[model samples]
Target: MTHWPDRPICAFDLETTDRDPRIARIVTASVVVLDGDTVASRTWLLDPGIEIPEETSAIHGVTTERARAEGLEYTAGYAQIREALCEAWVRDHIVVAFNASYDLTVIDAEGRRLGLPGLATGLVFDPYVVDREMDRGREGGRTLQAVCAAYGVTLTAAHQAEADALAAGQLARALCTRFPQLADLDIMTDQAAWHAERQRNFAEYLSGLGRDASDVDPQWPIRGIA
Candidate 1:
């Protein structure tokens, strides 16, 4: 059987208007297809139909004025993004992301809000989760930038959707290469259980520290769905 890294990869990323995926609006999105030496990518900038908060704009460098002027309408742009991701899934590509729960949740919530079909989640790979699992206690920071550095992957543009997506694909490949046993795991079932356990542990840690762990969801890939 071909391992995940040897297969085509469709990595995704999003820069949004808020940290809460339930309420966040996509300001920019990217889908990067990496198949062997060939790479293809699509990116979208959406107007989000709401004010791009100053702090969020500062992070993504997408001002509300620029987005309104140059970005596609949110619903339209998001529809195209969903279509691209669905096509990737249809092609049997492994869907990859850095912190997948956030991005995928944003996509899922956006699809629901826009009345579009939901995303397929069976073959998803999150390098963040994988890294946490593989290298249990060795982390300083697990942010994409830090993980990229740890894996010797160059991330030239940190916040740009296209750059982040591409780097995530590279990071996923690097991880699979280093941890060859990862190929033996089932993406859907094993990853779901692993993520749930990881979240539960985190919640317990928070509770021990007197922090509310209620917001720490145990769902993987997507959350808050009924």
Candidate 2:
């Protein structure tokens, strides 16, 4: 499997220590590689340097002692994940996520924590933003489950990293099926252009509702938006 598919993609998700990407550490992460239609995957549980908060633990269920005994030591696990994601990115394969900014930011922050470089540079696809753009003028939406329902994709396990990523990737496929607007995207789509276009569409949609979604994503110094 040295060569990739015409639609080389990977659906991935990460569980972290907190909500803030700058400080949150990765507790676990998974990558489901997609070669055209077939899939292969690998996942990792890591010993995040900090104690996992009960609130987050309640969500993903990795406890302190359990992780220390069972999970890979933080540095090695982090390095492996970083290497895997970077390898995929280098191959021009797109990494798909639901709310991509949150996950990707956490990854970057985690890299700094582990003394490793960022895994993904710019090529990524986000189903959440795509759904919002497609369902403009609709009310009571913007969640992964909601979007999946809107597109007639069934919801499986929610918040489980691997499940969510797989669902998001499927949702992306459905969107391309119905909309055909996002068919050309890949994991290496430059964040600057990607985020800018998404910001524009989202802002207009929100303004139509007299609300502001401008601050939805933190402004980062993206390398290649134009």
Candidate 3:
């Protein structure tokens, strides 16, 4: 039997209007299924219902005009994205994301806005967090592109959702191979708890600096409703 880490996993990513997960509309999204080192399947969504700001479009290449002409309404577009992810979960595939917190939190906020079902936080694998925890203090940067280069994974089309999603999947596979701990099933089971501890630690550090820590959420993969 294939080890859990080497099996098919779901890699997801999103391109949005802005960085704030609470309000950004997803302009493009990709769900790429990876089996070990191979990409087995892929899905893409584009033209999310809102106006795409020029700055955002410059980054992701999806313009407001293109979105208005081809994209589904915001609610419907999100529904499609949600259904694809939920189905991946239902099939026992771990959803892999580069920086899972941001993507999942954004998805959660979008869910709240659309009245859609929220994602199960525990079913996620975040290469970014795992890398940071296991290989601390070794980096100049930790963005997806940075991490990919660190892992010797090539990431073409840096901000494009499908390319990013595919690269993230490759990064996960690479990390699992390099760090045996990441391949274990326990990573999935302990993800939420781990994030809680991480958040608490950061909150404490912030508290020492006189910053409020009460609002820091410990929710890992998917933040609770906005």
Candidate 4:
């Protein structure tokens, strides 16, 4: 069997208006394509048209004023993002995202908000879930920065979409190097099962604590409006 890293991968990431993926507007996005070592990237900054709260702006360094002044219109920016992802998939590259669910969810939501058809995020690889599954006993944080550190991949610009996307691709390469089984797994099928199992376990845990788990989405890669 061939190593997954030998194939093309489109690593994606988004900087958003807030933490809620369902409603948060995309402030910036990056799609980094990796074929072996050769790399190409596309990035976008968009005016979300909603006020970016200072607290959220502090994270990705895109204040509402700067966004309005320098960024593309939200619809145009999101259209470019969608087109890039579609082009990557059409080229047979699997889309890779750090925590795919959140990023993809934002994409789905944004597309719907713009009255565009939902994008298919089925053929996607999520290093975050794969790492958690493969190394269940690993201590400490599982954030992009922490995981990159664990894999000896330097993540220079922490919250920026372009830097994060490139780092995610590098991290995926590291994981595939460490666990050949991960490279063999079918992301569309096997990963859906894995994500469902993870969600089920999480829901059960929440249920034990008397918290409602009914709204927990089991969708892998992307989640649409519930």
Clashes (backbone N, CA, C under 3 Å), per candidate, total: 0, 7, 0, 0
TM-score (all chains, Cα) for each model: 0.95, 0.79, 0.87, 0.94
lDDT of 1 by residue, 1-226 (tens): 3565577999999999999988899999999999998999989998998999999999999999999999998888988988888888878899999888999999998888888667666589999989988888785898899999999999989999999999999999999889999888886677778889989999999999999998888888888674
Instruction: Indicate the residue-level lDDT of 223 in model 2.
Output: 23
Candidate 4 structure, TM-score to reference: 0.94
Highest-scoring model, lDDT: 1
Model 1 regions lying over 4 Å from their true place: 1-3
Enumerate residue pairs that collide in model 3: none
Residues 8-98 of candidate 4: C-alpha lDDT, one tens digit per residue: 8899999999888989999999999888669999899999999999999999999999999999998888889998988887777878999
Winner on TM-score between 2 and 3 is 3
lDDT of 3 at 25: 82
Residue 122 local lDDT, model 2: 37
lDDT (10s digit) by residue, model 2, range 1-226: 2322235778878888898666778888888887776888888988886788999998887887777788898888988887887888877787788877777777777676657655446366777766665666778768888888888887677777777777877887777778664544442343345566767777888889999764555343222111
| Alpha-carbon runs more than 4 Å astray in model 2 | 1-6, 118-122, 184-217, 220-226
Instruction: Report every candidate's CA lDDT.
Output: 0.89, 0.72, 0.80, 0.87
Q: How far is candidate 4 from the true structure (C-alpha RMSD, Å)?
A: 1.7
lDDT of 3 by residue, 71-173 (tens): 7777777888888888887777879998787888888888877776665653688888888787887948988888998999999889989899989988888
lDDT of 2: 0.72
Q: In model 3, how large is the Cα lDDT of residue 38? A: 61
RMSD of each: 1.4, 4.7, 2.4, 1.7
